[model samples]
Target: MASALNSKIHAPGNCPGSKADARGGAGWRMDCDPEMHVKMCKKIAQLTKVIYALNTRQDETEAGMEALREAHQEELQQAVAETEARLLQAQGRVGEEEALRQRIQALESALELQKQLTQEALAQSASCRLETQERELRVEAEHAERVLTLSKEMLELKADYEKRLRHLSGHEAPRWDRLTKEGPEPKAEPGCGPEMREVLLEVERLRAENQQLSKDYARKAEELQATYERENEAVRQAMQQSVSEALWQWQEKETDLRKNFQAQEAALQAQVRKLEGDLEHRGRKISDLKKYAQKLKDRIQDLDVQLKEARQENSELKSTAKKLGEKLAIAKDKLMLQECHVTQKTGDMKTERVSENEVLRKENNLEACSLHPQQDQNFAKECPCTKGGTDTQTKKEACIETEYMKQKYEEDLRKIKHQTEEEKKHLKDQLMKRLEDLVKKHTVEIKSVRSSVEAERKRLQKEVEAQLEEVKKKSENEIKQLEEEKAALSVKLQNSLLEVLRLEEFIQQNKACPPRGDEKPQELDYQHCNILETQ
Candidate 1:
């Protein structure tokens, strides 16, 4: 505004010379001291020169201020651009993290799928093993049945041999007496029957022992099957522990990835904050320039009024000089009072212009002073000339614009913060859901496996118990047959002993009557060998 103040003096059309000459002729010159007029002219000349210098200085100051304002505005635009770029970069990073999260989720899903497949495969394998074991048990049971049939055949054969022996014992006594009484000694080994009986008994005992061994082998096979089940349980536990460990490691890796993403986001936020600070300072500078321009416009208008008054005064001075030429020395005394009035008017105009300039300068300074606190700190550092460059309302507008931008940026930051939090929560929820699914799947699989294992164990145990009962029944039947055969053998030995004792007593009674030895031998001598029941 100060730079615009040029040629702004107002003068009235009634000048000192013109007014003095109008009332009296040369009295205009006679009343005013000639020396004072010359002094005033010299003063005006010096003051004009000073005003020109001041205008030059003001122009330079204004130019410099304009350049500074433009530079600050450019800086503000650059800062805003940088801030926007930073925000975009942060958004990019957030997008990248989201993508990574998606990929991680996909990976986790794939792993879960693989785990499920593996579990299914394991179950199938376990079923196959059970089938194989069942086949083995069936084969063992078949072998045991074959051995039992063989034992039964051997027992029937022993019973047949005992019946044949009893038939021979019943018929042999009459044949032995005839052979001894009618023939010269027909000597054949008489112990062949006993030898054959001993050999048959040994064969039956061997068959019984073989059947017992088969029973023992079947019992051992059942024990081995139980041991196999225990081993399978231990192996299954080992696999479960390893699977849990791997899942735990994956969770640790997931936590590490999340922490890294958060750290990068925090660094980006710091960069954004620095840019926002610089943008606010530049906005304040631009506002200052606007107010300065307004001040200059007002000053220019005031100068136009000053110019119009100056032109009218110059015309009046010319008219006064013409009137003074007409009324020379006669009006000098009256003109002195008119000269006094003109000087008073000139002084008043100059003083008023000076005061107005001072007031405008003060207002500009006050306006410039109304800067943001943050800008003021920087202005104190970089721009001392900021004081008197603009008006108060211009600074106020800057403050408002800065506040609005700050609020907008803060709101955006808040929105971004909210989105980030929500995304994190969403990701967490997804992770938790996946974890729950894994747990549920694992739990279900474990329960199914456990039930299957239990079912299989129970089925195998029942089969083994059934086999054991079958073997017991077979053993009891064999034992009963063996006891019956033992009792019959003991009865045959007792009958043979009683026949030998009776024969000995008869022989002793006949020994005292040895006279008829040559007479036909009685058949009774061979009777001892004729016991068919003993056979």
Candidate 2:
């Protein structure tokens, strides 16, 4: 019987009584005993159960693998999101740095412009001062020239008067000698006495006029010199005051500009340092995020490896089940042959065979109940056949136990798949939320930074405008003062010219009328002399 069973199990498809041929024949019929038919039906039922369990296990494993794939996809998405966020942050920091650099350049340009303006103003002031000084010196030189000319004319007039006086004295002595020799004869001439008296009166008057003229010329010259000196002193004082005030104003402006430049430079340096620090901090954060992403990638790789292994195991189980199915088909063919033989021998043994099958089924149920679920599956795999049992019974029991194991495996796989799906969903949601929050926070920070920069720029502009206004006011005041000083100097110059003209007119009038000794001097000439003496 064992040899027959072996031949049936290993039979080729082309053999006449082979399992394949039996299943293929359209008119094939079994003339089998009832007890043997029952046993074969039980084996068929067990094989079907095993196939159903394997299909269920395969579905569960596929589901579990799908869950693992989703989880890996979610991890990859999260990594991509984090990388994009880091890139955005880096770009923002770079933009901020560029803006700061532009602002610094603008400030530097403004400072340079201010310096140029200050320099131009100083040059204008200096030129104006030099021009004023030159004008004053010219006026002084003119006054000195007028004074010297007047002094030379006065000296020439004094020498002429002295020579005329000596001539008059010599002629008078000769006339007196002649009058003594011919006194009686001269008494006989008409009007001689009266004429002599008149001559004497005129000489006395001329002498008095000459003395008065000398005194008036000396006094006028002294007055002219005094006025010229006083004017020069006043002009000198004004020039000194203007120079001193200009120096003081220029000093004050320089000091203020220096202080402002230093303050602006310090502020710019601080802002640059702050921006650099922020860049460094951002770089560190990006590096840390990159490391975290790498770790996630490694974990995803491990999950992929596990999923491949699970798929490979599921395929192996399917192949083993296929082999078991082929064995069960061969066993069914052998059981059919044995049933035909028993039926030919007798029909009276039917009740006994049915009772025996029932008792064997009951014992199988009891054994299954007594074993733990895991142990039952392990026992079935390790010991498919018992020493006292027939080969068909052993195979049938092994198929049933294998089906139970497959069912358990499917249940475990289904549970694992459910858990993995939940975890994947939860992780995806968390990563998305975190990314959203980070984006919002970065946006808010960028807005605040922009506002601060604008405010600082406005403040700097206001300060520069105010300083320019102050400098303009000061320059205007200085120009006004200089103009006033120039006007005063012009007025003084006009007055000095008028005084010099008056002195020249007086000297010319004295030269036009001179006193005579022979004829009596006119009364008008005497009055003019008296007026000149008083002046």
Candidate 3:
């Protein structure tokens, strides 16, 4: 019994009994059986070993679960990142398409504008050509009329000269015939000879004057013809030069317009080609995105299956841990019951006195032995609770963040809306002001244009009236001059007719006298010759 007591006092499992042995001494030790103490110690050792194996198995299972969780988290993060990247790419593509569409719309507008400009240019050119052509035709017609009028005037002057020459020739022919019928006047008297010589001298002077007038008239006609030809040639050259210059300017304008139009067309064509290529590339990218989405779907499905399997394994581990914990509790309860019976037996032998330090040490040892499983169970329980707590906290924080974002967004939106309204109002006011200003400007311009047009019309009318008055005055002056010339010619013709009649009367009187005698006839002829010469 003493050896058993010594062995019990030294055994690791009977540390609490050592305190009692120290307090009760040998008397308390003599009450306990050695065989029972040894059996209790062996049972405790076996229970501790079982507990250690359970704890190691649980730790290994937890380690495996932790690795799986980390892998799942990594996969989830990778998938999330990939999906986010794809979404961003899709958004970028959508933006590009929108931009391309806007560009196409702008190009179409520009093309329409170019077409309108070209059409306007063409219309203006056509109108300009028509006006120029009309002006040229009018100028040509006026020149033709002037040429015709000059030709008619020249023909009339030629006719007048011929008629005057014929009249002078007929009058001279009658005088010559009278001389011939008389068979040459006899120079029988001295007074007749002097009178005849004076008459011949006057006749020679009149013929010489007639020849000088004809030569002067012919020279004046030649000068007028040369001046007319020079004027016509100068007018034609001016018209040709003006027409050629206008044609060259018009051709230059047309070439410039064509070059600009062609350049615009080429640039637009290049833009269209570039747009088409971009659209094709976008189409290819869309197809690639579809295939990537399909791949993501497959990967998500696989991840879902893995998650389900992990969930099942976790549940199974939890159930196993619960069973093991229950079993350990029952074993600890049985060991506690045996220890209580041993303490009762020792209490009957003597007063059971336990030291405060030994009780504290015993409690600490019991806690240490059970701490692993209890802590594991507690940790397992706390894990979900902590996870749920963290999840709730995160959810709450997320909700608060979302609410804050919403409030901020609303505030910002309100501010933006207010700003937009202000901008709109300002723009509206500006537009209204601009519109009013434009209306006023246009109205002023219209009034000014109308006033200018009226003034121009009045000025043109005054100018035209003045030109007409000047033309009428010039025509009237020309008519008056022509009439005066006609009157002078009529007076000269009457004088010539009277002289011819007088000469005829003188010849008749001479014939009637029948040359009575040479002296009488010579005296009568001398009187007639003196009358003719004086007239």
Give the range of the ten consecutive residues with the poorest summed lDDT in model 1: 1-10
User: 1-535 in candidate 3: lDDT tens per residue?
Assistant: 3344345444434424445553553343343344444554554455456556656665766676677678767877887898788789878878987987797678657756765764575466456545644654564455445435544554555466567667756766775576578777643466556655665675677667656655654455345434534653464455455445544654565566457646655665565556556655655565555556545554555455445544554564455446545654554454454344444444432342235335545865777677887765565575467445544553354345434543653464366448646855775686567557755765675566556655655665566457446645654564475356446535644554464355456535644543221133244345434543543
Q: Alpha carbon lDDT of residue 75, candidate 3?
A: 72
User: Where in model 3 is the C-alpha error above 4 Å?
Assistant: 1-135, 162-255, 314-535
State the lDDT of candidate 1 residue by residue for 1-535, as single tens digits.
1121111111234344344333332232234334433443443454345445545554555565566557656755765686677568667756865775576467546545654654454455446445544543454354445434443544454456556556655556565565568577645457655654564575567557556644554454344434433443343344334433433543454354335434433433443343334334433433343344334433443344334333333343333333333322222222333344544543444355457667756865675688566765564554334333433433354345434543653464466448646855775686567557755765675566556655655665566457446645654564465356435534643443453345345434434333221121222222212322222
lDDT of 1: 0.46
Please identify which of the two predictions, 1 or 2, would achieve the higher lDDT against the true structure. Answer: 2
Worst 10 residues of 3 by lDDT: 515-524
Q: How many residue pairs clash (N, CA or C atoms closer than 3 angstroms) in each of the candidate models, in the order given? A: 13, 0, 0
Tell me the lDDT of model 1 at 250: 38
Best by lDDT: 2
* C-alpha RMSD values across all candidates: 34.8, 17.5, 29.5
The lDDT of each candidate is: 0.46, 0.57, 0.54
